[model samples]
Target: MKTTIPVAVAFVAGVVLVVSFFFDEGTWVGGISQEFKIWMTIVGGFTILLGAVSITRVNWSAVQRKKEGWPYKLLTLISIFVMAIPSVLPNTWSPLFGRDVGSIYDWLFTYLDSPMMATMFATLAFYIASAAYRAFRARTAESTVLLVTATVVMLWRVPMGEAFLNMFPGDIPNWLNTYVMNGANLAVQRGIIIGAALGAASMSLRIILGIERTYMGKG
Candidate 1:
């Protein structure tokens, strides 16, 4: 009954959403589709609450057991409440209570969270460079072409690299930007987008028809 109900709901929702696009916003199907979207947003809010509860339980359990790295888990729990509690309170209570500008939430996100994220991404740049080095080895014909193209693209991005390309005569930078980026790259991207769209459409159809039952958690 659980599986049957979810599948039926999914089918109806999918059909209504798809059919809604063909009709005007004032129509019955369109209204239902809009209502479904609002329901999805409400579900998303509940999902966030569920996630917070799940994380708190896991971290609190780890801390209670005195597991290795329990301090980090405790810190995570503290950070969650410290950030969340203020944001939910009334803005009139204090200047730092709500999520508005200059509030605790805004300050933490802008200063602490943003810098931490930037530092993490900066650390990842080295790993990306290492991967690029391994992938750009010119042992095969395809790899050699890829290596050359990557070199050109990288060079075209920087001032010194653009200067080096200009040393080779015949407007190398212009040619690369015109043919390689705007022409070849754009064409390949469009082809990939079309292929992905078709794949998504097929998957959606399978889900709507109840053929994709894996989402029910027991296939």
Candidate 2:
């Protein structure tokens, strides 16, 4: 029953979404997918409250104990609530806080959160390059092929990279990214998405079957 339930939902939802994308002629199928997404969004919101409560409880306990950085913890809790409350309001007109609370949230996401996330992601380029360099020695024929592919794709990715090499006689970089590189990346992306969908469906099956008792109350 557990496996069958998830398989059913996955089969129905996946087919409907795929059909909606391809057909685009009917409002009914699209509406169903949109409603499912909204339901999932609500579930995500409630799950977030679990994490927020855990954080607040730890910070409040620290403050009660007179920990050295207890004031900072309190400030963190204040910031979380300040940002979250407005976003959760049923409508923009709700009396959550100041009239422009939504604007404040948007500003934080644009200027503060976005730049921080970008910086973190940018740092990964260096780490990936270093790891590839160490791990991609051309000791074997297969290794040589892998190394060449990785190097060519990496260098062709940027303008300066294309300019740095005087040896490329033709439009090698442009051709690679336009043809080979893009094809490989797109294939990998599609595979990842399919895998993720399957994983989510399997987890949903566990939850619906009561096998995932982690969400249930203490027995």
- RMSD (Cα, Å) for all candidates, in order, is 1.6, 6.4
How well is each residue in 73-111 modelled by candidate 1, as lDDT tens digits? 999999999999999999999999999999999999999
- TM-score of each candidate? 0.93, 0.55
C-alpha lDDT (0 to 100) for residue 142 of candidate 1: 87
16: Cα error in model 2, Å: 13
Off by over 4 Å in 2: 1-43, 66-72, 82-111, 125-143, 163-171, 182-219
Q: State residue 198's C-alpha deviation in candidate 1, in Å.
A: 1.1
For candidate 1, the TM-score is: 0.93
> Measured by TM-score, how close is model 2 to the native structure?
0.55
Worst 10 residues of 1 by lDDT: 128-137
Candidate 2, after superposition: displacement of residue 127 in Å? 4.2
Per residue, candidate 2 scores C-alpha lDDT tens digits across 1-219 of 765565566557656665677655448877887877788799899888899999999999998998999889988888887777766555546544343545656666667778989999999999988987687699999989878887777676776777864366877877787767578777988899999999987876665544554544322
